[model samples]
Target chain A: AQSVTQPDIHITVSEGASLELRCNYSYGATPYLFWYVQSPGQGLQLLLKYFSGDTLVQGIKGFEAEFKRSQSSFNLRKPSVHWSDAAEYFCAVVGAGGTSYGKLTFGQGTILTVHP
Target chain B: EPEVTQTPSHQVTQMGQEVILRCVPISNHLYFYWYRQILGQKVEFLVSFYNNEISEKSEIFDDQFSVERPDGSNFTLKIRSTKLEDSAMYFCATNRQFADTQYFGPGTRLTVL
Candidate 1:
């Protein structure tokens, strides 16, 4: 079955620590990948996306993601996490063609907790 | 920067009652989509509308669910007879074209009791 998986349900780190969130997808072909963050009582905000070209994509709020075709992974990372970065992160994928086109399949999401 | 907007940030309704969630997508956007996220679950796609008609829809978008752009500005998702399972955060997203980046709205939290 084609799906997106975020292995970590919850992650905690001290302020200014580096962070990495794992994401893996099972699909026949390469799909459009994206990462979105949601603050409490807020909407989903686009953090970054990967379509083609560069394997490492940079997004807002000092976040970046690397797409590894061999491993079917698109992991998100931040060099220095801020307290405001504590939120739920979702990884999604959309097929590049055929019946699955434009239909976004999202992962279960990983919640990040930042401690002062 | 343009953003999508949804009305009635939150709503509470009894089961079997009808509910219409509204959204105002970016004016320049040409495609619109709807998705729902249940508590502690992944977001699921419901439907997509283009040129005033549904171009694609998932199994979740059944008979009870309908979408329309009645006034050419406001996009709406109507659930004829909502069920308890329908309680979730419904989101509206739009993009200037298909296969492009989509902008999602703040979302409307629907609580069906």
Candidate 2:
């Protein structure tokens, strides 16, 4: 089975401040990781995804996440937070093979709040 | 860019009634999926469809839940009997074959009373 854990339930940061949201996953095979954002009452918007290659992967809206196999983490990072960046962030892992194909296990989620 | 689309932004139904949610996946995508998020929970995968049949599904997708690709671009999910617990925002997503990124629709808020 695959699972994701987002340690932070809520994070508040002032505009222009740096932000980091932690995500950890448990998977036996190569983990296909992704980050998604959802505003209130909206569907998920893909932030980025990591299948393989560079540990550092950049996403839309100036967000990026680093896949750290040693720690089983794929934490999202942003150098400057904008007010519009506030939303709920989720980290998900896709199952490797067999019946698990195309299945995604998501984290509880972390709500990001950007302040002025 | 083409994106996934779902109809009926909101639907209200009685507890014992059946409900159908529709989605129109991207024209060239080969995989379609349904997911739901309760008011305060994480997004949960319901089922996935490919080649006119279900390729995968989660435990939440039980006998009461069913999916179909009746046409080239339309994918639909039907819940036999609605439960209050089924109230959630349902989302439709699509991705190209062998692709890791899935694009999601605006979502339909299903409210069962």
Candidate 3:
């Protein structure tokens, strides 16, 4: 079984301030990690994904996340957040192998609120 | 990014009524999936379809729920009897291959009253 935990329930940051959202996962095999964002009334958009290679992966809207295998984490980071960046973020992991690979287990989610 | 579209951006149905949600991929895709998010919960996987049959499904995907690629293009999920708990944002997603990044539709907000 695979699961993701997002420690922060909600985070508020002023415009131009740095932001980090924590995400940890439990998986026995190589973790196929992903970050998704959902704005009000919008669908979940893929922010970034990590299958292998670089530990740090960049995503759309200037967001990035680092896959730390040692810590079993893939935390999202942004040097500066814009007011429009306010949205709900989710971290997900796909379990390993077989026909069972398509299901993506998601975190509880973290709501990011950007202030002026 | 892969593209997918879902119909009935919002659907309102009376409890016990049947509701069908549709998903259409821009191009041909072998894998199609359905997921849902309750008001304040994580996005949960419902089921996945491939090669005209279900490849995988979660526990939440019960007997009342069904999926099919009836026309070889439009993939759909049909809930036999709507319950209050079935009210949520149901999303349709598709990917090119196994372990591939899935592209999600804007979703259909199904409200069962």
What value of lDDT does candidate 3 attain over all alpha carbons?
Answer: 0.92
Q: Lowest summed lDDT over 10 consecutive residues: which window, candidate 3 chain B?
A: B23-32
Clashes of each: 0, 0, 0
Tens digit per residue, CA lDDT, model 1, A28-110: 88689999999987889999999999999999999999999999999999999999999999999888777764777899999
Worst 10-residue lDDT window for candidate 3 chain A reads: A94-103
List per-prediction Cα lDDT, in the order shown: 0.93, 0.92, 0.92
**What fraction of the true interface does each of the listed models get right, in terms of native contacts kept?**
0.58, 0.67, 0.78
Q: Is the docking of candidate 3 incorrect, acceptable, medium or high quality?
A: high
Q: What part of the reference interface contacts, as a 0 to 1 fraction, does candidate 3 reproduce? A: 0.78
lDDT of 1 by residue, B41-90 (tens): 88899999999889899999999999999999999999999899999999
Chain A only TM-scores, each candidate in turn: 0.97, 0.97, 0.96
Model 2, span A1-116: residue lDDT tens: 88999999999999999999999999888889999999998889999999999999999999999999999999999999999999999999986555576777899999999999
lDDT of 3 by residue, A30-79 (tens): 88999999998899999999999999999999999999999999999999
Judging by lDDT against the true structure, name the best candidate.
1
Extract clashing residue pairs from model 1: none
